[model samples]
Target: MKGRSRSTGLLLVISGASFWGVGGTVAQKLFQEFGISVDWLVTARLLTAGVLLLAVQFLLKDRSQVIGVWKNKRAAIMLLIFGLAGMLAVQYTYMASIHHGNAAVATLLQYLAPAMIIIYLVLRKQSVFSRQDFVTVSLALAGCFFLLTNGSVSQLSVPAPAIVWGVLSGVALAFYTLYAIPLLKEYDSLVVVGWAMVIGGSALSFIHPPWQMDFGSLSAEAYLYLVFVIIFGTMLAFWFYIESLQTLSPTETSLLSSLEPLAAVFTTVIWLNEPFGIYQWAGTACIFGMILLLALNKKKPAKSNDSVENEEPLRVS
Candidate 1:
């Protein structure tokens, strides 16, 4: 049963990431046809996800766990921060990166989250890096900087604000990944997602009022895609992401999910007819090699060090 459950969990995680990987394609399509603002889309996604998640929790008799987090001030505060910093801030900045730069650039830059995770752990003194860790981090960093560079050093001209937003998104994603582990132990995945969505949605709704939405302007296709983003992209993906957190450590999950950018790049090339460049593929290969290195060299703590606790929260979206 344990093995089956784990296999099931791993499957869920991969499927969820895959769903999210396709979301950008769907989103790009919607942007072309419906003229929807990314801010509004983000707001709508958070609200719709929160409602559906809460509905599922109640229907599944998961309210006790939901109420438990509500009663704990520390957990409640953490959820709020997770909603703000992880969900709202990260998505907002990422969308801004896409808005200011090309989605390809934005997508490639965000996967730097894994390297940021390693840096954060090192800063916390929780990381004991082997040569493998150094190699992975070095390769990931080189790939990121190479993608950020435009033509030549003298010709580097990407918008400073876009670069700032992309880097901030990566940092937020890294922190979110690290924090997700311990939170997984404290609450059911859905419960945590529900609360985070509620807070995140509520926060966004305040920034972009619902009254501003033009309901009558939407077409059937737009609504369909919108529903897809909310249901599959937000709700379903978040559940599996959180479930993956249950079994995979932060570094493992972050490294694996780095494939999200690779998926995005390929999907863009095929769906959007975006021209692929050799430099981009080379950078992607380097990132992939880094991820493989991390996966293969994952170290187990010493046999005598069984008491080392995993106190970090599990972050999935």
Candidate 2:
């Protein structure tokens, strides 16, 4: 029974990560082929996914917690900041990276969030730099160098704007992961993430309404892709990852989650025919190695009451 449970967890995490990875590629296709704007897609995805997630929470979990979060002034303020600064920023920057470059590079770049989080903790004096930390940071920097330069420092393989957006996506993701800890501890992860998405989507709607898109320009296939992005990519991806945590250890789940970037690279290169250099592949390997190192490190610094293991939120974008 235990073995079967572990197998199910492995399948669930793999499926969830793959959904997120493939979702990015599909969003790239919409941007490149269908001329979809980042703002519109971000707005639509957040709003639609946010609503659907909240509905799930209402049905399966504590319904009061959905609106209950807004009742607390401090929680409400944090939620707003998380929604706009963390959620909206991460979503927009990631989509913009995809728009400017391909999904493979953008996905790998965003995975740098773990490195950024480590740096932040050290700077904040919350954690001391250990040998593992040094190795993780070095791997991340080396991966980034190879990824952007593809062995040539004089020129970049990806556009400057894409690189910038991708880095910002990583920063936003770090903020998103760190900031959500308190909320996750107080309320359910679903309630916190769902509300954050709604708040972010609601705020963004004023800038770029989801209804502003040219419906006539989108074909049936394009619409199907869009729906997949929101439903499978955003909602089910998060749902499956969170569910798997019930059976799998956080370390195992994090290691398996590396499949997200792998899936993105595979689909972007094979399905989208995006060019990936040998050095870029090396860079991807470095990042994957860093993730593995972090996950396997058993002597990690102790966190506060809001340890990441309490609620390991999956990256929705």
Candidate 3:
């Protein structure tokens, strides 16, 4: 039973990561081949996925968490900030990265969030600097530089705007990772993430309403891709990752999720025929190396910050 549980956890993590990677790829396809607007897609994804997840939580999990969260004005306010600023910003920046570049680059770029989180923790006095942290930061910086510049300052291999958006996505993801911990401990993952989606989506709706987009103009295939993004990418991916937490430690879960970017790179290069040079591959290796570096660090007694009650923010990627 122990072996079976471990295997199940591994499978769940792999599936979750793969779905996220493929979902990003499909999103890129919609943007590049189908002319789908990022605004419409992001809005619809957040709103629809949020409603679906909350409905599931209400039916299958804790119903009270649905309303209980809002009963506390303080917790509700933090949730609101997480939803509107963290969720909305991360989603928008991530999609924008894929829009400017390929899924591979965007996903790898977002992996920098781990390093950013480390720095934030240190600055906030939540965590102290370690040798491992120094190594992680070095690899991340070198990897990003090589991936973007390819060892020369003469020209950029990737678009400048894509890099900006990708870095922003990492920053936003760091915020999501750190801020959602308290909420996740207090409420179901679905409650926190679901409401966050609704809040963020609603805010963006005012900027670019989902109804404003020409849905009819898109091909049936495009609609299918969009559905995949909402269901498989956003909802199911998160579900599998959360389920894995039942058996795996947070560190193990995070290390395994490095597969997300690897899957993205493979799909983007092979399926999408995107150009990824040797420098990019090296950069990918560095990012993955950092993941391993963190995961292999000596484990300590779980704390609110390290514990995964229902979800790890890594799932959000």
Best by TM-score: 2
lDDT, candidate 3, residue 141? 95
Count: clashes, candidate 3: 0
TM-score of 1: 0.83
Question: lDDT (0-100) at residue 88 of candidate 2?
Answer: 94
* Local accuracy of candidate 3 as per-residue lDDT tens digits, 97-121: 9999878888888889878977876
Backbone clashes counted, model 1? 9
Better by lDDT, candidate 3 or 1: 3
C-alpha positional error of residue 287 in candidate 1 after TM-score superposition, expressed in Å: 2.0
Clashing pairs in 2: none
TM-score of each: 0.83, 0.96, 0.93
Kindly list the per-residue Cα lDDT of model 2 for residues 186-241, writing each as its tens digit.
Answer: 89877888888898899999999988988997899899999989999998898888
lDDT of 1 at 117: 70
Question: Is 2 or 3 the stronger prediction by TM-score?
Answer: 2
For all candidates, the clash counts are 9, 0, 0
Clashing pairs in 3: none
Best by lDDT: 2
311 Cα displacement, candidate 2 (Å): 4.2
